[model samples]
Structure formats: C-alpha cells, structure tokens
Target: MSERKMCKFYNLNVPDRRSGSGDGGALNHTGNEDDDRNEDEGIQPYVPPHEHKLEYSYWMWFSQRPPTRDLSTTTTGYGQALRMVGRMGSVEQWWGLYSHLSRPDELPPLSNLHLFKLGIKPMWEDPANVNGGKWVVRLRKSQTGRAWEELCMAMLGEQFMVGPELCGIVLSVRFQEDHLAVWHRTATDLAAAARVRDAMKRILQLPSTVNLEYKVHKDCLRATNRHEEEMNHRS
Candidate 1:
C-alpha cells in the first residue's frame, strides 16, 4: 500500500487508556478509508469486526538506506527515513496491515522494518532502548518471511514472559542472509535476555546450526562509530 494510503488506516492520536486488563483502555486503534471519511464527516471511527484487544499497543516503521549511504542504528537523522506506517492495538488491526505488506523479502535491499512498543522509537538511542540489547539471528532469504511473521505474533502475544523487558523486533533486509533481531529493554538482565533468547528459538523453531548473537545497544553504537571512523581514514 502507498504510504499515504497506509497512514489513512491508523489513528496517530489515539486516546491513552492502557490498562492492566489488556482490554478496553489503550492508546491504540486501526482505521481505514471509511474511518478516514467518517472523521472528515464528524462521525465515529469505523468499529472493527470482532475486535479483540491486545495487551500492548505497537507501531510499525519502515526505513531504507540511500543507495550510497550506510545506515546504521547510530546514524544521525535516522528518523528522517524511518516512517511510522501503522499502529495496532488489536489482532485484526495487525492482520489488516500485514496483509498489505506481504513479506520483507519483497522489499529492496538495505531496507528494514520495525515493530516497536507504542511510544518507543525503533532506535538504539531511544531512552527505552539505550541500555537494551538485541538477540539477532541471520537467516537465508527463504527462511525470513515465515520467521518474521511468527516473531511478530510471538511478541504481540507476550510469549517470552520477559514482561516489558522485551521491547520490539527488527527485520533487516539484505541481498542474501537477512538479519532479524528481538530487542529487550535491559542488557544487564541476563535472566530476561536468556528467556528472550530461548523463547525466540522455540517460536522460530530455529535449527541447532543457526547462530544467534546478542549485542548491547551501546556496544553496537560504539562499534558502528568506530567502523565509520576507520572507513573515513581509509578513504
């Protein structure tokens, strides 16, 4: 779907009503063309069909590197290219948007898709993520589509039992192997990180041959800057 069309389906200014009940109170909702028209006509949002609320709200983002630019998690003005495309508070809402964006493999190389908590920017420096770390797995192009979908479901369902320690998921598209990382809120919480890792393995049904790595966000930021400095010196 076109970016403009997709934005029409999400209410960016949803009311804040998050509740422990995981229902009713939430600052999230998905809209459609009908709802857009209704808003313009001073009518209520188009109520979804059999809408069941999720425990937490989320935002989906899309970003891509310029052909000659190297985009990293630490890159400045990263938000310029990172677009918040959809927000979801219910299962049907997620399915509505997912149906339009079939798979990441279909996206161009250097592109990345992020599904993060409602208020969290999909960036390492975002306060919720600065001290966090991510568990990353590289899979062949053929393996990413299914894995990415399942990972999305698992996170939305809170299957890890890590609580809010689990922040979001990032799917980085590349030419051959694709990298998918699950971000957690605390890097020092080894127990939480371990649970995230174990849960990811079970959810993705990863094979023993698969290598999963963990990198603290701060470490990644430092490494990225160092690498860029080296590249500059070389040139």
Candidate 2:
C-alpha cells in the first residue's frame, strides 16, 4: 500500500485524542526521497499492522559532515547541516518515517540522528535544553544501530521513568566511535540526574563496568566554539 494510504488505515484503526505540543504544534516535516528500509533487520518480510501511541510526539532531525577544501579541516558544520526530517505523534507515523529512512549504519560518516520532543529543537541552544546536559555512552560502530533503536523505543515507551526532565536522545555517528546520549533539562539537579542515569543504565542494559559521562550543554557549547576558533586561526 502507498505510505499515505497505509497511514490513513492505521489511524482509522486506532483513534487518538490525547494532545500535546508535538501533536498540535507547528513543525517542519521535511524529508528526503530516499529511505533505509530494514537493512539492519535482515530484510524482514512483514511490518506489524497496528498503530501505537506515545506519551508525546517527537521531531526527527538529521545532519551530515560538510565538504571542505582541506581533507583534514574537519569542519562538520553539524549545527548548520541539521534539518528537520519529520515529526511523529503516533506509532504509525513513527514507523512510516523510520521504516523508510536510512539506518545509522547506512548514513554517511559523521552523520547524526536526533529525536527530540515536539516543540523543542535538538540543539543545546533551545530554551528547554540550554541549562541541560547529556548522559553519554560511547559504543563501537558495530553496536550502534541496535543500541540506538532500543534507546529510542525505550524513550518513546516512557520506560526510563526519568519524568519531565527527559529532553531527548541523540545518536552521533563518527569515524572512530559512535555515541548514544540522552539529554535532560538540568545539570545541577544531581538527585534527578542520578535517577535519570540509573534508569538509562537499566533500560540500555549497560554493564556495571561501563562508564557513562554527563556533559553540561554550556561546556559542550564552549568547547565547540573554542574548536571553531582554533580552526579559523589555522586557516
């Protein structure tokens, strides 16, 4: 069936009345024609026919490394490259977008996928995220796609029990190592942050031997700016 028709059918099967900023709010909904389709799932023949509802809607954003004259310039322009790929308030909507899009493994090196609550931008500059920080877990390239999928599912299902402090989740694909991080709204709320960290560890099934780092958004922004300055000086 055509994607549009399939969505209509799914929506008809399960009507939803719960409203949130993401469900009724303005969104960018832009996307590319190419889709990634079950590449990581060994070519599944069937996709479930039921619709699922999430607590809140989310927006998907994508970014890729930018081209530069110098091969070693490393000017990814991640912020500038980021663009809204789509928005999903319901299970059918999410599946429609995710099923067709390229997986993290299929994306180009240095690409990123950000899924943030609707009405909130994925950037640290967003008002909801400015004072926040992210709990990060670095993973080998081979481990990223499945880990990312599980993380997204967990967040959407509200499995973390992290409360309203949960902002979003990001998957950064790099040449050396990929990363999966969950953003929360406060850096100083150690108690809340600890709860979030523990929930994250449990949901992701990380071992006690693994270490996760939480970086404040302000610190990340500062480091980014400093790197830009150094690159400009060398240029």
Candidate 3:
C-alpha cells in the first residue's frame, strides 16, 4: 500500500497549490510531459478526479521537536515552532497535500502534523481555540496511521455534526506511543461537545479499554505551565 501511494502523489517537500494562482496549477511531481496534459494544470500525475469544494478551508501544518527542547513547555512558543505547509480549499487540494506527508508510523519521533481550519492557528490559546478544548486518545503506533487518516476524512466530510465547533485535529508522533486529538471552539457547549465526542468514538472505533480524554484550553494553560516548571526543576 505504501509503495503504491508513492507512485500516485507528490513527496513530502512538495508545496500545495499557491492561493489565488491561475489555472489552479500545482507543482507536477509526475514526469508526464506537457503535451499529454489538458490546459488545466494542477499537480496530478494521473487522470484527476472531479473537483469537490470543502465546506471550510483548512491549513496543513507541521512541527518537529528539536533535540534540545520539548514543546510541552509553553503555549506561546509552540505556535512559533509550527510551519504552515499547505492550504486546502477543496477535497482534491486536501489529497494533493496529504498524500505527500510521511505516514504516522514513518514520522520521526517528536514530530507533529496538524490540520486546522484556515485562519485558526492550531495553538490552544488562539482566540478561536482559547475557550475551546481538545479530545485526545492515545493509540499504538500500528493504529496511528489508519486512525489519523480516517479522522481527517471525517473532519473534511463534516461527519462530526458539530457545526463549525471543531478547530483542528492533530497527529502526535512519539517514541513509544502516538496520539490523535481534535480541538473545538467551545468546551462549555456540552451538547455540541458531546456530539463531537460521540462522532470521534464511532469514527475511530476505539476499543472499550481505550480512554478518550477532553482537556479544556483554559485549564490546560495553567496545568501545562506548572508541568513544565516541574520538568525544568527535575532537569
């Protein structure tokens, strides 16, 4: 399966379609010559599927922990470390960007990939997310790839039924275990949050033993700082 994906999409370094560019042209990773192509050029090696516009535009972001530092230390600095890799306005754009990313298991430890609604930064303290919270579940490395894929699909498909409350989702790659999380606009909205929670459970199909946890953004702010201080003291 992995081998086949390489043949179909661009590699990790490939950039997404530049916003407002003409012809929706993207970088062509495939070696096909121009003569065989139609006037429309949007980085697809094969016969591209019909375009489908998404309800909301999304941004693809990536961050890797440097050897000397840990990201858990501060909310403010965490945003500084993130790099916006792509923007997706349509389903085709999503795949065009996602296909190039390293698989969850293949990612280096301490790396993260984030897909969030456009204009809403992934950080918990962002105005769009400051009052919101996140739903997180740890999974085995083996389960990370598929689960992450399905989660993103559900988000893009609007299956959560939570109506613009969701801010973004993340895949955290670590040494021993991986985690998946989805952030929302308001933790206080119990009915909406509950729907988001139920939708996550159904989509991930997590086993009974697995725990799904929710953390409020404001609460996370103080706790995260305290935890960072403790770790610093220990070091």
TM-score of each: 0.77, 0.72, 0.77
Model 3 off-target regions past 4 Å?
A: 1-20, 25-50, 67-72, 226-235
Task: Point out the worst 10-residue segment of candidate 3 by lDDT.
Answer: 36-45
| Higher-lDDT candidate of 2 and 3 | 3
- lDDT of each prediction vs. the true structure? 0.75, 0.68, 0.73
In candidate 1, how many Å is residue 14 off? 12
Candidate 1: C-alpha RMSD to true structure equals: 7.1
lDDT of 3 at 61: 67
Alpha-carbon error at 128 in model 1, in Å? 0.6
The sequence of per-residue lDDT tens digits that candidate 3 reaches over residues 198-218 is 899999997777789999998
Give all candidate RMSDs, comma-separated: 7.1, 9.3, 7.7
Tens digits of per-residue lDDT, candidate 1, 1-235, equal: 4445434434434442322333322124454544432233212223345787678878787777766655453367476677666667788767776776647767778888899887788888889999999999999899999999999999989887888888899999888789999999999989889999999999999888888999999998888778778877877
Total clashing pairs in model 1: 2
Residue runs of model 2 more than 4 Å from their true location after superposition: 1-52, 67-77, 229-235
